[model samples]
Target: MAINNDVLSIILGGGQGTRLYPLTESRSKPAVPIAGKYRLVDIPISNCINSDIKRMYVLTQFNSASLNRHIKNTYHFSFFSSAFVDVLAAEQTMQSKSWFQGTADAVRQSMHHFLRHDFEYALILSGDQLYQMDYKLMLKEHIKHGAEISIATIPVNAKEATSFGILKADKENIITSFIEKPDAKLLPDWTSEVSEEMKNEGRNYLASMGIYIFNRQLLIDLMSNPDTNDFGKEIIPNAIHDHKTLSYQFEGYWTDIGNIDSFFEANLGLTDSIPKFNLYDREQRIYTRARMLPTSKVSGTTLDKAVIAEGCIIHAAKIETSVIGIRSRIGKETTVINTYMMGCDKYESLDEINKNKTSILMGIGERCFIKNCIIDKNCRIGDDVRINGGKHLEDKETDQYVIKEGIVVIKKNAVIPKGYVI
Candidate 1:
């Protein structure tokens, strides 16, 4: 792809991802693995790359080691080309010796580096979303409208509208008002005026995708304000009244993988006949680290509509409607239904496996019945373990696992003892 040097991409990777809990317990939100082999950071970066926007910076703060490593190893640009993907970790400054307070604040803090480059537009994106987008089209709209900032907006339903920052745009697509999770009673007022097609389809509202292309100087001035910490909460809402902010209407498959339940559903959605976010799109493919591993070997495993990644060794496991990650190891007589096993980083060697056979175990145990659960990376499940959703749990945390939105999540590197049923 030819490089577009007019813009500089800034990805918000500094999020602690508290909602994603144990997944974000060890690493930054962006570092969390997705689908099977790809990291969460890969989605936005890939979008930028595919969009021909070459220069990029990933802002990270909490648990940045793994995120930094992944970026360093996965992305490599030619010396001849000016394209680069860099990580900007939060740091203490003389003027303010504090960490990034919010999304806008993170960009505000990293202004020095971004300003150093000669770019007209600053493309800001969220790290934890599943979609494919061409940002160049957005850039064109920003230029055509003669706007100070161009926000990427998506048509959403009323139920999902409650979670997002809703916006009302005029016939010309100029944003008139911005509401951050408005009251249910006031929803009708905030609902967007869409086309007849969209109205008939039940998409009555427009929500922010947290994607924005800002005029360099406008963003600099906004970030300079001490009160403007978050983009959705303060910055965007105020900008609508003052600046010429246009809504670049985006009609595509976009999901904010905010919590465990949404994440689980998104993963399983890929296993369907026609997934919302098609990962198999060759033209607009989701890029990730190329792991050089042997092909997955499955013996006596009945996989019905499942996406089993590379380097997996499955033995007599009946996986139905699931996403088994790379380098995964499923033992014999295991029935995995509606589960997401984010496979291990490396396979346990024969020596390592033999030494840790008794007390320490790795991978799925025999006769394990894992249904509606997410087994994070490097988890150790012992014999006859059951990860069936014990009860209808909502936003509950535990020592071994967490139940978010009624879906159980076995944390990364956690161990489930022999014959444990939970």
Candidate 2:
């Protein structure tokens, strides 16, 4: 495939990720695991890679070590090639001595590094969205419309419109107005002309996907202003009137992984017979770290609608509607349902396993019944544990786990003792 060397990709690693707490407690939003194997950042990076946008930089501020390591280990281009994916964490320099304030600020702070590179357009993407898009197509549209800036817009229903940055575009797909998370009462006026299929589905409002393309010079010029800290809240809304900003309507599957409830649903949704976000598409392959791990070995486990990754040793009695990540260990007589177990970082050796037999061992132990939960990586879930997460349970947090919107999230590297119940 002929790569788009003219466009440089800039993936924004979101601030704090407080809504996705615990998952983002130790790591940044981009580093959060998804689909049992790949990190959240992998989605946009993979999309860019698959779209032939090779020169990229991932800008992050908080908890960036793991994200940095993942990018360093996963994306490796030839030395001869200019294609590269680099992590640009917030640093105190002569110009600035603070962390990234917002999405635009992150890009602004990293402009010095970006200015060194040669590119015609800047492809700004969110690190935590789940979708497969061809940037080449979007780029072609931007050039066709002679747009200085292009924002990817998706048709969203009225119920969802209030939660997103809604916009109105002209007949020629040129954006005229923008609103940041408008009130439900104002939705009727914000509706854009979507496809017949989208309109039939009651998806009339065009919501910004937080995906944008800015002409190189415009991006650099925008960064010069320190007042604008966010793209959705500031930049796009202001730029629509001044610039020839085109609204590139996308009718593909795209979900903003903003909080725990949405994150949980997105992961579990992959267990569907045919997921909205297709991971099986050969053309749009999701790139990730290549681990030399053995194939999963399941014994006596009756699996149904489960997406189990490599290096798993499952002896569970049954696992339904769940995603078991790489290097996971499920002991005998365990029943896992509607859960996402992030799996272990490293395999527990036979000696270590024997030593921890009396104590809590890595992964879900024997006779456990876990449902509607997110078991973070490297957790030690002891024997006879029962965690049934649902609306019946109120939101609360403990040292070991957190229950938000009734979904139990076992913290990463947490140790749940024997006979524990939630």
Candidate 3:
């Protein structure tokens, strides 16, 4: 089918992002760096672009400056074309003076702006997720089923199902019942008819992917009510019986980057021999900002399963199962394992580097040993610093870093003194 021009995408930027703290301390959740160079927001936007859905609106509230700047710098189209990506920050308006209360309320507050556009459907997506999907296929299924609302569902095991909103679909794939994060005891009754492969893997319950396609009119009618604040918790549950909701089952590499542990694992997972979320797919390309940066220069580094971005100057002793971001500078004899080092924003001048010879400098320092950690952007690690994250360490939060679930997250622009140990 031809590209669907009748749909407008609305990417929801999550609130606070306290779970992914330290990383989200300065920037919004969507603006957090992911998979070496790309930001988290790039995933859904790239998916939309690949599906030929150009126009998109990103709704955000806290720390939206970086997200706004990233979107503006990355997504650009011809002036003659209708393609554009805009950021809508929460504002006090005549209709509503409060901030976005929940997922549904965020769209409701911005409905006026959406109404000005000419579209038949609204594709709502979460900003903090890692997955690639052709939204066109879901749109096609929505139309074929004559669905008022269509939710992308994935078969998840009972352990994982309790964390998401589960849906039970009828023989026609029409959603009949909905429960928001059901109890473990309710798993048997909530199991849906998934494929044989999913069944064999003990993934029988259908969990909502938090991706939805709502008919424009139906969305408008639903938004008129101020009571329904969240889609999964309130709207979906109430509308399942009344509306013709279809569950578009998707079996792919989808993971919700809700917390620090998940985010850390997701980045490290990319260093796998064959990652489930393929970034090398020629057809399903992941788009990001086009920077005019030089190629990375590696010398004497024994790299193993490392994904390094452009403009890096690496001389580390060894880097295994790590994602080194753009403009990173790793000094000699440093060992980074199972870590994500979000590189610097800009290169430090030679003069500046020389002046800081006796002080902490940007990127990993010499003789440092960092393992199972996430070094945020522009971090300076002095020589001989050691951070070994594991279950032995208890969860704690410092001014410069945070240790959650045994994963150390160095805050953005933090400076670790020389010879420091954790």
Candidate 1: lDDT over CA atoms? 0.88
**Backbone steric clashes in candidate 2, count:** 0
lDDT of 2 by residue, 393-417 (tens): 9999999999999999999999999
Please write out the lDDT profile of model 1 over residues 31-65, one tens digit for every residue: 98888888999999999988998899999899999
Per-candidate count of clashing residue pairs (backbone under 3 Å) = 0, 0, 0
After superposing candidate 1 on the true structure, give the runs of residues whose Cα lies further than 4 Å from its correct spot. 1-3, 357-360, 390-396
lDDT of 3: 0.94
In the range 1-422, model 3's lDDT, one tens digit per residue, is 43557989999998999988988888999999998899999999999999999999999999999999999899989999999999999999999999999999999999999999999999999999999898999999999989999999999999998899999998899999988889999889998888999999999999999999999999999999999999989999999989999999999899999999999999999999999899999989999999999999999999999999999999999999999999999999999999999999999888987887746778988999999999999999989999999999999989889999999999998999999999
Candidate 2 global TM-score: 0.98
Between candidates 1 and 2, the lDDT winner: 2
TM-score for all models, in order of appearance: 0.96, 0.98, 0.98
After TM-score superposition, the amount by which residue 232's alpha carbon in candidate 1 deviates from its true location, in angstroms, is 0.8
